[model samples]
Target: MFGFGKKQDQPQSTIQSEFVEDVAPAAPQVTSVSSASTPSPLMSVSSITLPGAYLHPITKDNGIEYLFINENPMGVPAGKPKERMTGSFGPLPMRTNYDKLLYGTGAAYLTGFFGGGIYGAYRGLQIAQGNSFKIRYNSVLNSIGRHGPRISNSMGVLTMGWALLDNTIYSFRGVSDYYNHISAAFLAGAIFKSTAGVRPALIAGGLMTGVVGSYGLWEQFTSEKKETKIPSLAPAPAA
Candidate 1:
């Protein structure tokens, strides 16, 4: 009985010692993995770089200077300055849709005024050839007053419609080029003249399309030429 008891006690002690040894090795493995996964602060700081044309700010025992791309900074590319898009229509530089609308309205009003004046003058000449001077003047003034508001209302509606269509196409289809502008103008004119007559619709559409398209083309061509004459100088790429 004493020999059997000693054999059981010896096996139990050996098993506990083996279990402790296995757990000890696992602790060190876990610690090694944690240390390897940790990132160094110095490495993170050294990896950052300046973006775009902005020069990296150098802080040392010396001084500091804010350097820009075309301002002749050291180690920067030297060339002509870049041409930024003005997003303008003639003399009006539109920064928002509201600006565009306001300008469009004004342009429409001016066109209406000129058109009415021309029509009134033609009618006045016809009246002068048949009636007395007093009648001609009255007739001319009446004709001007009548045609002015009519032409203005029509033109205003057409301009607003064009703006709406242009904005819609740009928002949904991302098509805001010259062709898009011309198409929008033509479509707007057609829609405006739909109730008038077939001939009127065709005439209005053709006129609007030609005017807007030619203007856009001219602007684009001029801008391209200017850009070509002045090369754009960009800074080094950011990391």
Candidate 2:
């Protein structure tokens, strides 16, 4: 037998092999969010601003009134004024209620002028077709029949003219931008009254008209502001 291969033996370590233990990661501790840190219950509000005009609505929560700028947290009240939040457009001053009322009434008056003209036209037509005609024997009186219908028509014409004047003069564009025109309407009303015998009811009506017009205009200025606050999910604050 030929000694072709000889086997070699290797020495093993005397220290016994120690097994490594597996460890798990510690779980994160959850913390509760406070109510004060969460959002409030109020919903979306609106705000608007224009040249020399500031419009916004007041919303109160928990006995505190908040004045929003554009109806959003975009402009929050860092502090309150010394007197009170009377009127302000966000960080700017807002128009008074009187102004708002005046704007609203002006719009109504303008609309009524057109309505009145239509009514006057209808009345003129009715009067002109009257079956009962009175003819006076007097030559002067007999000649006035033609003028009676003409007078009614003239009144209708006057009403139509007034409607046109109101449309042109008191329109939103005119009143908002043209202060001179606004003054002119008031002055004309006053000046014409003295010679024509100013009617107290008409004056009162005009004031009411202006007030309504101002309110309507004020409403248009406000735009909605959306908020992400969810009041229901928020927890109560600790005392």
Best by TM-score: 1
lDDT of every model, 2 decimals: 0.56, 0.34
What RMSD does each model have against the real structure? 20.8, 25.0
Candidate 2 lDDT, 176-196, residue by residue in tens: 322322343444344434455
Q: lDDT tens string, model 1, 25-47?
A: 12221111123344444443222
Candidate that scores best on lDDT: 1
* Candidate 2 segments whose C-alpha is farther than 4 A from its true place: 1-76, 82-106, 129-192, 197-239
Error of 2 at 219 (Å): 16
Q: After superposition, how far is residue 95 of candidate 1 from its true place, in Å?
A: 2.4
Model 1: residue 50 alpha-carbon error in angstroms = 23
Task: Work out the TM-score per prediction.
Answer: 0.53, 0.23
